[model samples]
Target: MIFESSETSGFPVATPRAVPPSGRRPGWNKVPEVTVYFWTIKILCTTVGDTAADLLKEKAGLGLTGVSVLMSTVLAVVLAAQFRSTQYRAGVYWPTVALVSVVGTLAGDNLIDATGVTVETASSVFVIALAIVFVVWYRRERTLSIHSIDTTSRESFYWLAVLFAFALGTAAGDLVSQRLHLGYWLSAVLFGLAIAAVGLAHFQLDLDAVWSFWTVYILTRPLGASIGDYLSRPSGDGGLELGTVVTSALFLMVIVGLVVYLAATRVDVTDPEHTSRHVA
Candidate 1:
């Protein structure tokens, strides 16, 4: 891995160069490498999160409060296991992310239902909160790259950022598709285009890699939610009518398959020696 800091913004910009993995160790880093598999599984997890929340709430008869408490407890437990581990295991790490997605969706739903908050307002607040987390994280750690998350404090910041991003994505997705009445398919298209533009800026126009990565990361949540809604909602509501259970099951199966393959292959493991040398 290689990165250079821009003097104007002080953000590390990754260069498209890497060393051969001569002495690399799997599970040395606390996060997976930013690869196609990572993004594919991430979007799947978000889609599952969106549909599963609805499944547990409506079909299971858990209601919003009950589902919130149940998922939050489970997330706390998984997160504890993640923190206790010294390195990244795909099993531990991906579960934590999936649970975070569920909890984050429930959080946004609970806040809106409980307080009658507008989706636009909730979206704005989450954006501010996420921005604050990044500011504090960068100030304390001097770099916001996932490759640099070798310490406990950095991991804490990373999770906090992830949680907020999920919440913000939920709110933003709702604002566009529900509140603004743009419809789910259109919302998905818009976010997908935005992610494509960000990719173009990063790969072809010299945008900072850290910014590109986080920008895509945040955008995927809304895109995935839109897709989940489009697939699972009733046909009367302009969806394919697969229902939440079917949609969640299909996406979860794909996610499990991918994670299992990645675990067996260890293709997404970061080279600690290379990361430490270049990430800062």
Candidate 2:
């Protein structure tokens, strides 16, 4: 997250730099390779995470803090297993994502409801933290491409960034809907459009891959949360009245099906040759 300010022939130049080098290595990709399927399942997981957490908190009688801790502990275990595996195993990777998504959402909830932090302040803090993580990650690894996530350190940074994005998204989403009173459906639509804008910028406007990935990452959290709220909240709360348990179960099934398919087929495996071409 270190910003480099230097004089280039007496002209000031500002360069954003990561602290850790990008850890360009040859092996299973550290970050999940991006694909339409990747995005599709990610949003699904986020929704599941949101609804499931809510159900656990309300129906299961675990308060917000208790549920957050439980999910965070589970996420840590899953992530540890994910890191231990040598290859990009979809089975390990996506479950870790789902657990972390739930934990991350709770983190934001704790910050606002438990601590009374303003959404604006929480969002701003998360942005700064994310920037710092990126700065350190890039400075050590030397690249920020997901295709280069081969080392342990870089993978750690990647997950930290992911965690922050989810938390940030929660706060930002709540800010728009609750504070600004935009309502669930409208907020979901807004974040959806924002995601589209990021895609357009990435594909057509030639945005940097690092920027595109992170931008979309943040947007996805709120988008997923919106979806979760829309499905699980009471009819009085603007949801479809499906209840959290049913919505969570439905999404979990879909996620399991997709993960099993990816694991069996290796559909999302990053092609080493294709990645090398991009680097070259």
Number of the top TM-score candidate: 1
Q: Which tens-of-lDDT digit does each residue in 153-193 have in candidate 1? A: 87899999999999999988888787667788988999999
Instruction: For residues 1-280, write the lDDT of model 2, one tens digit per residue.
Output: 3333321121112233443335446546754557767888889988987887788788757788788878888888999899998868899999988888888888888888899989898888888888898899877776666666778887898889888888888888877887767767888899999988876875687666567667887888888888888888888888888888888999999999999999898767766665444443
RMSD (Cα, Å) for all candidates, in order, is 5.2, 6.8
Q: Kindly give the number of clashing pairs for every candidate.
A: 0, 22
Cα error, residue 243 of model 2, in Å, equals: 0.6
Q: Could you give me the TM-score of model 1 versus the true structure? A: 0.89
Poorest 10 consecutive residues by lDDT, candidate 2: 5-14
lDDT value, residue 226 of candidate 2: 89
Relative to the unseen true structure, what is the C-alpha lDDT of residue 269 in candidate 2, on a scale of 0 to 100?
Answer: 79
TM-score of decoy 2: 0.88
Q: lDDT per model, in order?
A: 0.82, 0.77
**Clashing residue pairs found in predicted model 1:** none
Q: Which candidate is the best by lDDT?
A: 1
